[model samples]
Each structure stands twice: as C-alpha cells, then as structure tokens.
Target: MKTVLVIEDDIGIQKQLKWSLTDYELVFAQDRSSALTQLRRYEPDVVTLDLGLPPDPANASEGLACLNDILSLQPECKVIVITGNTDNEHALKAIALGAYDYYQKPVDADVLNIIIARAFKISDLEAENRALKSANVGNTDIIGNSESILKAYRTVEKIAPTEITTLLLGESGTGKEVFARAIHRQSPRVNKPFVAINCASIPENLLESELFGYEKGAFTGANKTTLGKIECANGGTLLLDEIGDMPLSLQAKMLRFLQERVIERVGGRQELEVDVRVICATHRNLAEMVAEQSFREDLYYRISEITLNIPSLRQRGHDIVIIGKALLHKFNQEFNTQVQGFTDSAMQSMLHYAWPGNIRELQNKLKSAVILADSKYITEEDLGLSARNAKVDTLRKVREVAETQAIRHAYTLATGNLSKTADSLGITRPTLYALIDKYRLHDLRNTETEN
Candidate 1:
C-alpha cells in the first residue's frame, strides 16, 4: 500500500482524517521537527501539510516554513497544503514554494481523498517510468521494454556477432544508426573504426567518391589520396544510411565492391582489397524502390542478408513514456534544470500524440521544456502539446474501457467458451455472463453455447 504523511497539529482533525482516509498507510506529525523526522523515516510520496501548526496556530508562518523544509529534503514529494477558509494568499504562497496543491479548511474527506489519490497516481507513474529507465541502463543507445522493441533487441543480439550484412527498416529518428553501431560493437572487429555515411545527404555525383575515396587530382578538390568511409572502416563496420537514395548509376559500383570485396578509387587503377562489414538502413521501402526500378534489386538482395524492423514510438506502447522520462533526465543535467515529472494532462498528451518524428521529436520537445518550464512539474504547454488534443477521461470511464477490453480479449482468447472465459478472467461464470450482457456483447453470447 502507498503511504501518506499527515502533518496536522490538531488532535481532532488528525483523528478525523485518520478515520476517514483508511485506504492508505498514514503517518502523523504534529510539528515541523516531527514532520521532518517522520518524512525521513517514511519517505512518503504524498503528504497532507496543515499550514497552521504549533508555535503559530493563528497564522501560516510555521506551516509555510515546514512546507519549505519538506520540499528542500524531498523535492519530488507531493505536498498538499491545508489552509484557513480565507487564507488564499498563503495557499498560493505555499504553492510557489513547491507545494503540490492547497486545500481550504472545513475538511471534506471526499474532496481531499480525491486530491490525495491523484498525487499517488502521478507518483506511481513517475516511479514506473524511472524503473523502466533503470531496466535499460545497460543499453546506452536503445531504451524500451515493449514487445516490439524487445523483439528487435533480440534480433540484434542474435545477428550482432555475425558478419552478415544488416538492413534496418524504420521511420526516421527510430535509431537505425544506433542499431548499426550496436552491430559493430558486438562484432569481432569492434576495436577497429566504425564509420557511417548518409547516401541521401551527399550529392549524387560525389557519393561514389565518398564511399570509395579519391586519388590525387581525381576531382577539383582532390589534393591527395583520401580514404573514404568504406576504406576508413577497414576491418570494422560501415553503415550506409538512407541507402535507398543512392543514385542508380552508383548502385552497380557498390554492388561490385560488395561482391568482390575490393574497390578501385576514383582516377586509380589498382583495386584495394577491403574487408569491412556493411550495414544499410533506410526509411523508404527498398522493395518498392526496386519495383519502381529506382533502386538496384541485386544490391538490395546483397545488403539485406539480415533485416531488422524497428518499431515506431506509437507502436511501442508505454515505451513512449519510458523514453520520454529518460530524455527528461538527460536534458535536465545538460541544461542545469530540476524539472520533475510530467503533469496528468502532459502525460495524456504525450500518449495521445502520433509522434510522426519519433524519438528525435520527443528529444527536441523535452530539451525545450527543461529550459523553459516555469514550474517544477512539466505541463502540457511546456511540451508544446495542446490540451485540446489530449483525450482526458475520468477514472470511471478509464475503468470501464479497461474492463471492456479485458472482457473482449478474454472471450476471444477462449474462443467464445463462456466457462473458459470466466476462468481466464478469474471471475465466476455468472459474473462473466452479467458483464457480457452489460457490455452488450450479443455476438459472443449468440456464438457460444455456454460451455
């Protein structure tokens, strides 16, 4: 169970709160000193701080000081300030001092409980996101736990040790180069150079020279013989990024080099034997390009000895938040900011957004947010996401959606067997039937013969 620290000095109010909020593990502190001690002992994520305490029961001075102290020690803790009926000024002041929220006195347990629950839920999300970061600590380049990412990672592990040419297929900013480097690092030639060249970035006339190098006086600027990316890699790996953009005229030379393991430099006759492992990546469909005759089919077949498909941010599910949190921590240090986790609206926006640019776009938004956020927690505005775009649902609505999905999934998995579906859902047959009827799953009832 989650813990909550209650820092109210009034014995009656404390007792009333303890009686009413029985769902959580509650710890009480009557003053600043006791509050700090209890805070150290419990390290609770949520705290109810009364802004009128001993030594100054009539004012909020001591309580505000206590709030500052609590935040100083635990900046991530959610501190909810309780104030007098007319103490709006102090409540706002407390908020400025890093309090999570403020509540006016004449305590209504239902409202306060709702606030506390929200705090805990946010805390849980941050904790889970941080945990995901820790889980990927060993992998410096890739960060995710979703099945799609895991499947790609598994493929990398299997192919990294081999000399097979790899073709990475994914949208832009999906870390295709990262996987290329991973393959290089895991190969026997890791100690050698690992080079990458983007076919799309270089001019069509110059890409061949860039890959195979140029001899002295080969072109206007060729002052001396220079090693190209392919030769520079030598025994290591060379990643040909955006290979689909390679000029059709140059693909034959590339194919020849790949086949013969030798390259004739521009304006040179001697073929230099090269033993470099090759990896190719592209956001465009090579097969489609080949069908259009823009890309060489022979080169495509040679480069794609092994293929890995990277999942986009939308397809990775909860990995989006995990990667976002990881980026937030990274930019925090780089920009010298102490921004905490995202707000409910901000998280919902992130989840709902399509992220067409993938991790690159996420990194840009987070870097900007860290530098410009006014509050400790990042809001939806900080992320450059509009609240109007977010699909924010109530707790009841979320629960109902989850229930409906679960029931439908279980029923399909059980092949419409009523008893088996109930057993898989860990509910009684009667309850399963009632839920099916409640959700109006008439097709399932019509198909199944109540086994």
Candidate 2:
C-alpha cells in the first residue's frame, strides 16, 4: 500500500480524511515536531502539509519550516501543501521552496483524492524506473558502439590473457576505470582480487605504505602488520590509477619492485615475493613527463608494454547522441519526469560542445535537464545551452554535416566497397555518386567497386 502523511492540526478534518481516504495507508501529525517524526518513521511518498500549526496557527512559519525539513529528508516525496483560501502567497512560496503542488482551502474529498492518487502514481513509476536502471548502470560493462570504442575493445581482448604490464591513456572522465575492470574480467585471474588505488588521491607519505604495506612497528600508529594493495592482489591484477602523480621519491622503489617481483615492507629487512599483473592508467602524458625528468623513463617502459588510448567523447562519432539517449532514459526514471528525448537544436548543440569532462559532463548535463524540463522533449534551454541563436540558419549546414557523417560511417562499415555502401545506405549507385560528388567524398570512394 502507498503511504501518505497528512499534517493538519484539526482533529475533525483528520477523522474525515481517515474515513474518506481508506484506500491509502495514512499517518497523521498535528504539529511540526510530530510531522517530522512521522516523516522519518513512515518515509511516505506523498505528504499533505497544512501551512498552519499550533502556537502560531494564523502564521505559516512553523508549517513552512516543517515543509523544508520534510523535503530535505526526502527529496523525492510529492508534497501537496494545503493552504487557506486567501493564502495564495504562502502557496506560491511553498512551491518555490520545492513543494510539488498546493491545494486551496475547503478541500473536497474527491479532488484531494485525485491529487494524492496522481502523486502516488508518479512515485511508483519513478521507483520502478530506478530499479530497472540500477540493474544495468552499476555493472562495469563499457557502453558504446563507436568505432574507436570497438577498436579499444579489440585491443583489450588481445591483451587481457597476457601477463605483460599494460598502460591506459585517456582524457579525464572517459571511463578508464571501467576499461580496467573489463580487462580484469577477461583475464585468467578473474576470480582473484583486482585491487585499484588512485596514486594522486592519497597523501604522498601514505602512498608507499598503501602500495607495499608495513610491519607492526613501521610507524607510531602501526599496531599490526598489514598487506598492501600489490600483496592483496597477488595472483590477480593491480591498477595504479593516475600513475603520473606517483611521488618521485617512491618511483625508484616501485621500479625495483616491478623489476624484481618482490616488495620489502616498511621498516622490515625481509623481501616478500608477489605475483601481480600491473595495469597503469593516467590522463597525463608520461612521455612528456619522462622528457621533463618528472617521470622515470625506465618505469614508463616497464609499465607500457602494451598501450591503449581511450578516445574522448567528442571524438567518438554519433556516441554523444547514443549516450545521451541512454542518460535521458536513466535520469527520467530517476527524477520521475517523462522526458522523451532531445530536440534538434539541443542535439546539434551537444554535437558541437567540446565536453571537456567527456562522458561525466554529458551525464551531469542530461541529469540537470531531466530534473528541470517542463516539456516532453528536452530543448536547448532545458540543457542550459547558450548557443540557441542560429537554429534556422544552421539547419541546412547541420543536415549536410549529418549526411556526411552517415556516409562516412556506412562506408567504413562496408569496408569501402561501393556496392555494399550503396546497399547499406539504401541508395542507388547513381544517387550515391551524386552524394559523393556533392560532398566531395572521393577519398571514401577510392576503394574497389563490386563489378
């Protein structure tokens, strides 16, 4: 049964509500304190808040405070503020403060019932959507169909079973960790631990101990010996993330461990042998750092036996729209908004934006748009995009670019065969020739024709 909290101090009206709304599991509170208590206890999806409470029944201060508290505690709850007939100001204020909706005084049972039912319906739909997304989004599967991503996957398939140390280079927020996990999953040591540590996030002093462990008396706080990440990941894989930021003082020690396949604990003389496949990832250029003498060249050569360069979101053609659609589904389910998809202008803007943060930035933008959108389709304004001026003038230009991209994609898929390209694009050879001429796509047509 759906839960509803009715926060009205009037005892007579409470009894009437209980009798009328027998279909719902109702919880009632007469004051702000009790209402807050009930909110935490029941965790209702719908709240009927009255903007008048004891000690100041004529004023809305206490009720508004209760509303804020409820919203802060349960942001997804649909709060229907019940205000006096002349208290339109308070109603609007409540809405601005995040109340879902408001009802004027002299509440009819049927009208109130309809409002509460609608709220319940929306909440249930959002809950179902969230459940569905949680099943897929939490997995380590890298989601993209772009050619760059496919090539990266091919590299991963080739290198996963080997014991050589691999290096992954990418722009920040391009799902390097996800790729790392994919490698681990495909490796022979899939059942074993895949330990990961961000070299830059931890303090320099603590980093050595974190990677190589310590003896009981290594430091003042060391009460017992502990295994480090490399030791813990024995017989498995160890991912050293943001390896460019590893302290110079520790680089030689790390290089020694990499060369010898053994680690010496802090303040201990005995060296312990460990079997671990090391995978290093960094957004920074290690080659430049090596030339600058900030990064050890020997260490770079040791770690980068095989290298995979992850493509940025902007470089992955048509992936922006594909990922955007997936995100729209996810956020709509999360926020309980029925946002269908992006508008033509919004899609064009997304295609044009540099997306400095890559997939992470796109996800954030779509999330905000989903929450703020008041229409079925998300527009450029909803996406908070500033480039909304040249919609009509740029339509033809955008179409041409889109057509060119489509031809390129089809050509690549067809392996540059003219007949296959024509068949894939559902166009006659003559029409294909005309398009190729119009767009000057002769380079794509340089391949063999199926005579």
How many residue pairs clash in each candidate at the backbone level? 0, 0
Q: In candidate 1, what residue range of length 10 has the lowest lDDT sum?
A: 131-140
> Tens digit of lDDT per residue, candidate 1, span 166-205?
9999999999998888777777988999999999999998
TM-scores vs. true structure, each candidate: 0.68, 0.57
Supply candidate 2's per-residue lDDT for 195. Answer: 95
RMSD of each candidate relative to the true structure? 10.3, 19.2
Q: Candidate 1 regions off by >4 Å?
A: 1-138, 392-451
lDDT of each: 0.89, 0.88
Worst lDDT 10-window in candidate 2: 131-140
